[model samples]
Target: MALASAMAAIAIDTLLPAFEQMRPAFGLSADSTQLSLTLTLFFAGMAVGTLFYGPLADAIGRKPLLFTSLGIYAGAAVVGALAPSLEVLLASRFVWGFAAAGPRTLTQAIVRDRFSGTAMARAMTLIQTVFFLGPILAPILGKGLVALGSWRYTLLFGAVSAGVLALWSLRLPETLAEENRRPLSFATTLAGFRSVIANRTTLGYTLAVTFGFGALFSFLASSELIFVDVYGRPSWFVPYFSTMSAIAAGVSIANNQMLRRVEARPLALSAGVAFTATSGALLAVTAASGGLPRIGVWILLFSLANASMIGFAPVAISLALEPMGALAGTAAAVVGFCSTGLGALLAAITDRAIAGDVMPIGVSYFVYGVLALACQLWARRASKPAHI
Candidate 1:
């Protein structure tokens, strides 16, 4: 499950270090923000693709859907590697993103089938912590491949990786039983969507997760530009980005530990407060310093802020899905759609808002953090108290 989820992270973060190299090769003008679309489009594809897979998985089975989706991803990766034009590359990437959503979202339904309450939250964080290694390692790997030959080699590597995972998924057993399987139909899928949307608390939590993902997507879309272009330290991009991912993974583990004794609500609230303060401070400092902060200052503040925000995901996801076990596939789809789709939109907006400075992106993180906290609070108010 962790490996499957990591596919998206690897696809995006791995290519980040190669953006500058890819720009000229693909005929993009210098300093063009168009490259960021590669990452954002992938998420947009995931957002759209996830809506269909969940109900289909619930109706048919998990294994077959996994096989089909991963196969699409693998084929897309090959097409991406050989893409002759930027249009072809972006289109293939979107298809890859759409395909990758199968394993990524369906795994959540698998987890929900096997666990509940705090156990489910713990499982999620643990899987996420493992999953985060992809980000920590992908940039370095991409950098290495770029060093070896060309950015196309990095794309080829993604192809091989997805192909391997696709075959590996063949051995996994289906978690959804015959008795629990819903008939695959438009009406059944629509009913599941309505069930999730009608629940105010679940909807609020899902939106909160969406905003949190939006903030992270904005950062990912801009990180390479900020470090390489704005800061003039192309060499440090991999290390700095890797360190932030490492911090997120460590925080996930820490969150899992805290969940052993602390309730997710309080821990999540504390994280929200920390994220807002740290990110807001970073924004203010950047503004005062006349655009970008010192590299050390930016890394430290962004890492801390991201760590706080990352810890909230497991808690929020688990809480939102707890009451929707029967609707797990559709619920997970809704969550994936809102978070990835809306998040991608936010990232694209923030990317366009960049004006040769980090101010817009920095301010976005602060604003996103604040809105995320508000959504969490609303979710809390709407739901009844539970042990989680």
Candidate 2:
């Protein structure tokens, strides 16, 4: 699950520092940017893959479905590495995104099948922590490769990671018992989706998770640009970026620990408050300064808020899946797909929209903050009092 979970999702992080190398090679427009092409894989993958992976697991068995997905991902990584033009690269990214659905969603389903309630949340947190850590390391590696090798190494890393994960998954036992497993046919999967979609709280929880990541996606889309383009930080900025990102690790673990004490909903509220206040403060400072906000200050402000994200995201996802106990794989896939896809789409669009000036990012963060706050409110209103 760790390899699978991280394998498909770190595409952008792995390729980020190489944006300049890819930009001219692909002939991307100044405004359109490599950002769109790079981010496309995740959004498209999450959206469609979510719809597909669940039934695939149910029908064939989770192990095979996972293996097949990783196999496809390996092929797509080769294509991305060898892409001759911008259009080809974009197409490859889209395909890669679709292939990613398997690893991301299947991991969730597999986890739920093995555990439930508090243990389920703990497992979810563990998976998230692993996935989160991947991005932390991916960019520095990307930078190192770009310096010593080429952007192709990033894609090669993907292929190798996918291959490694596929081999490992082959060795793991299927947790879904035969008697309990529903044959994951298209019709049956759709019926399961229908049931999930029909539940108001479940549906709302999905939306909450999706919108919550909107801000994070916005940051991912712009991180390289913010450091390199705006702050003029070097390609090695990955280390600095990862340092701030590590703050999320501690907060994530803390959230998981607190699960035994406080409700997920309240944790989410505290996260929302931090996210909004920090984004707003940064936005206001950037605006008042009339230009560049100090890198150190911005990093400190965003890092603190971002750290809490580790806790907030998993809980909401667990909430969405709680109602789909038996269909945990299917539910996790659905929510994973929607949240990531939407976030990617938003990231790409916002990246394109905010290209000329850095100020727009401050605005974008605040806007996303508002939406997140609203979603949290709606999520709370619709749920039973979340148990501490």
Candidate 3:
């Protein structure tokens, strides 16, 4: 599951290395160069598909959806690889994202299907470590491939990877038992969604993770620009961005290792506190200096803020969907939809705001920190009644 999802993620990150080749091939502007990224994320919020995929999983089974979705996703990759125009490529990316949604939503559902308490945490940890490879090695890998040829081959590689994963997933086994399956009816679907919306704890945790991911999108959409255009770093700076991201991966490892001792709530709260405080102070410092802070300081602080988030996202996601065992896909759809959709919106807004300005980037960091802090406090409050 993680391999499949990460294969899809490589479509986003690895291509960063080859975007310039794609730019002319697609005839996109500097602004529109990111249109593929934006559409990929925007399609993430397309919840209409999951409304059916979930109940369909309840009806036919997870294996069919898993394999079928991968097949379609691979098809879309081929479409994207063959695309001759930016419009066509963007459309292909949108379809890829829509198809990829099943794996993203269902994989979490699979975890919810099998375990709870600390066991779920352990499983997510293993999945996350696999996931880390996509972002960690994708750019480096793409760079190697681009050295051999054009960007279209990157999409070709992604298509082939998806094909391999589709074959591999056939063996993961369905975890949702026959008796546990709910009827595939509109009433049941509505009730499942209603339960998710009605539960304050689930809703709160979802919101926190939503903003957390939104902040991630904001960082990613701008990080390359900040480094290449603003910092005047060498062309080799892409590796540095990937490296900072890898260093941040430690927070996930630490969170997973400490899960037995830490409990989800306190770890989430503490990470949120540190995340918001670190980014907020850096923003204030940047503004105080007339929008120019030391480059090293800016990178370190935002990098650290993101590091803090590595600990928060999975825990909050697990807590949110715990109650809706029957609605695992439903809850996951809501969370995944909101998380990626809002993330795209935030990234678009942040991308346009910065439009190549350091001040806007600083302000965005401040805004993201404030939003994350607000969501965390809301989650903290929502948890209070559980203890009562």
- Please, what are the lDDT tens digits per residue for candidate 3 over residues 24-70? 66566644436536344534534344555666676666888888877
Off by over 4 Å in 3: 29-52, 234-236, 384-388
Q: Report the lDDT tens digits of candidate 2 across residue range 1-388.
A: 7767787546778888788777666666533455555676656766787778876676566887888888888888899889877677777887888888888888888877876655667777767766778777888888888888788888777888887777777679987778767875667888887887877667877776676677677777677777766777765367876875566656667777887776656766777777777778878877887746777777776665566555577877777776677777778777877788887676666677664356776776677777767777776676774332
- The C-alpha local distance difference test score for the whole of candidate 3 amounts to 0.71
- Model with the higher TM-score, candidate 2 or 3: 3
- Tell me how far the alpha carbon of residue 22 in candidate 1 is from the true structure, in angstroms, after superposition: 0.9
lDDT-sorted candidate list, best first: 1, 2, 3
Worst 10 residues of 2 by lDDT: 28-37
What TM-score, over all chains together, does every model reach? 0.97, 0.91, 0.92
Model 1 pairs in collision = none
List the candidate numbers ranked by TM-score, top first.
Answer: 1, 3, 2
Question: Where in model 1 is the C-alpha error above 4 Å?
Answer: 385-388
Candidate 1 lDDT, 167-223, residue by residue in tens: 787788889999999887888789899999988778888888888888888888988
